[model samples]
Target: MSNWSIDAGVICFSGVLDRFTVPDLWASLSSWKPTEKGYLVDLSRVERVDSAGMVMLIHLLEHAKTENCHIMLSFVPKDLGTLFRLSNVDKLLAKHIQN
Candidate 1:
């Protein structure tokens, strides 16, 4: 199962990220209004991810870009990092990645 929360303007995600959980997450984030200088997406607690989850992240990145919102990805897991690198999205998401 996957869960998400917005705390102090940061979007926090926990649990496995798979096809079943991607849509709801997308919906929730799509409706978000940025009150801070930038938006932060925290994925450290996310235990797993499938292809669908990766696609969802890419789409979310595009959405944020179109909205002119600066969104950063923080605490990304090693596995996800490898996936992104292999898919060639790491460079595109480079500026947004935070260790």
Candidate 2:
């Protein structure tokens, strides 16, 4: 199972980020709007992620960008980072790096 929490302008994710969970994350993010401080998605607690998960993450970032919302990813796990690199999506991911 997977879950997320929204607090202090940050979205914290936990558990596996697979096909099943990606959609749920998408649904949750639909209601998110960036504040002046922007938004951050904390991935420190994310246990795993699949290709679909990665795609969904990209989609979320694209959605945010189109809306002119300032959002980023934080504490990205090594595995996900590698996936991003291998998939040649690291460039897009870089635009949303927390630090």
The TM-scores, one per candidate, come to 0.87, 0.85
In candidate 2, residue 82 scores what lDDT?
87
Error of 1 at 60 (Å): 1.7
Error of 2 at 37 (Å): 5.8
Write model 1 residue lDDT over 1-99, tens digit each, in one string.
898887876888899888999888888867766666577899989999887888887787777777777778998888889889989888988998987
Please give, for residues 1-99, the per-residue lDDT of candidate 2 as tens digits: 788887887878899999988887878776766553567889999999988778877877777777777778999888888889999989867879866
In candidate 2, what residue range of length 10 has the lowest lDDT sum? 29-38
Query: What ranges in model 1 sit over 4 Å off?
Result: none
User: Against the true structure, candidate 2 has what lDDT?
Assistant: 0.82
